[model samples]
Target: MSLTLPASRLRTQVASIIEGTGSSPAEARQVADNLVLANLSGHDSHGIGMVPRYVDAAAEGGLKPNSGVKVVLDTGALLTLDGQRGYGQIVGVQAMELGIARAKAHGSCIMTLGQAHHLGRIGHFAEMATAQGLVSMHFVNVLSRPVVAAWGGGDGRFGTNPCCIGIPLPGAEPFLLDFATSRVAQGKMRVAYNKGEKVAPGHLIDENGAPTDDPGVVVVPQSNGLFGALMTFGEHKGYGMAVACELLGGALTGGGTWHRPADTARTVLNGMLTVLIDPAKLGTQAAFETEARAFVDWLRQSPPGAGFDEVQIAGEPERKARAARERDGIWVDDATWSEIMAAGAKVGVRITSAD
Candidate 1:
């Protein structure tokens, strides 16, 4: 069974739970809004379901409350930031703000951030840049756990590195492209496990390297002491992109790579490399908007194939999902709701009803 709650009410409940963990009301609200927005956008894997883990991390001191970020290096157009193990939603927003400021002044900026908590939805940062009428791209890598397999390999070797790019449209919602390199994110598998559901074929493999749809295979330890692994999205193509993220976001940013030893005392960390550009610097905004509109409109004219609806652009589906979810309310599955309740209980926060 599942419960549906209005987005605003859901955000309030989530914020209350986070605040009980020692986060200020403002910080809690930011994190809650970010997670709920992911749910609204139809990406439940990155939604409020993660609150349990966040609470655990905070209690264990792996994620700090009210933590601050610092600039480790600065060169005007290029910089690196250390998040000091703070909540990714907060640290990420600060990092992007700095990047946007530098880009506004210099026309372009590249920034790398390390030691951040799970950076919720990567597209959110891109959308931030888009709101400022700037173009932005982000590459992210995770450390401490390997949940994805390399191309042609059977075992887990890397995290589900994600890539995102956002392009601002003068009078329209920004065009955002974001996806995990893995066929499915590890969190998606967790969602499946929580729902007591099996995943689709080709999304995962068992400990013995046999293809399996069982989400439990990915979460539970097998007799051989290994867990199932997610596959790369497009064979070599996705594997290549994942590698690039590891190198740029992980190694280059000074965040340890998957191959490095884990820090048992700390929780997982994310490293990100973001590039922001002022489109106006390259050409007139008027010319750019005209050409962009023309191209997108032309592309939309393509006829749909069998078993398909009309053509949809990179960001159209998310926009549609957001609209529908806002009107219908967000759905939380039974298992995830139980987890959230338990997590809230740990911090003396009670959620009596969906309403």
Candidate 2:
């Protein structure tokens, strides 16, 4: 069964559930907000669907509700942080703030953070920087051991590495581009399973190295959470990006490479490179703004294909979805809702649908 609830109600429910896990109100709200935003932005896989796993992790001490980030290294344009086992939303927000501050102080900044919990939806963080009038790029690798296979290989050797790019525009929403290097993110597979649907062909390979569309292939405990390997996007090219993301986000972030055998029960190590260009330094800020507006105008005015109303930019859809959902409410499927309610019940929070 599927359920639809107002975004605010859903957020409250989710926050209540998170707070039940020993997280403070602020941390709980941050996590809830991020997950809701993911769903509103059309990334359903990254949304409230993660609540169940989060509850499990909280029970396992994977998330330290009271933890905070600490600065380890700070240079003019570079910094490294330790999340101290805190929730990723809290640490990620602070890291971006540090990155933005450094970029404004210098010409650019790169941030490497470690020991954070599951970092949901990198685009949300990129949007945070973009909202601050800065350009940001993020690369995340999984050190939790790979469940996805390298292209043409059957064994798991790569994470569903994700990369994101955000470019600030003068008067509009920023241009945001984010995607997983895998043919399909594990989250999507999980969503399909929740809906009792099979995955698309070529998305997973069973233990025997044969392609399978069954979501069971990726379900945990079926093969020690390694039943099948996720296929890479673009065959070899996307596989290469996954490798590059792993190296850059892992080794460079000092998070240890995935190739190493380490216990990855509750920590995420990642890196972000942020560049903030001073329009004033480049040229006339007004001039740059004017030209960008002109270009966008021309682009939108271009002829559209059949059934298309207007040409849109990278972040337009997500921005529109966010606006609409904010006005109305976010939709929560039954399975995810049930899990969240169950988790909330543990903490004296009762969640019910609106009439």
Once model 2 is optimally superposed onto the true structure by TM-score, how far is the C-alpha of residue 60 displaced, in angstroms? 1.9
- Clash pairs detected, candidate 1: none
- Model 1 stretches with alpha carbons more than 4 Å out: 260-266, 284-287
Pairs with steric clashes in candidate 2: 7-329, 7-330
Q: What lDDT does each candidate get?
A: 0.88, 0.77
Query: lDDT by residue for model 2 over 1-355, one digit each (tens)?
Result: 8876777777887888788888888888989999988989878878887776677677777667878889999986888888776777788888888888887777577788776777888898888887877778888886564678888898678678888888778867778988999988788887777678887787888867788888767655455544677888899999999988888777777765677533436334444433444454454667777887889889998999899988998888888888888787776667666776776676677777752
Q: The CA-based lDDT of model 2 is what?
A: 0.77
Clashes of each: 0, 2
Which candidate ranks first by lDDT, i.e. highest? 1
TM-score of each: 0.95, 0.89
Q: What is candidate 1's lDDT per residue for 223-325, written digit by digit as tens?
A: 8777878899988999999999999888888876888432333366799999999988876778999999888888779899899888777778888999999
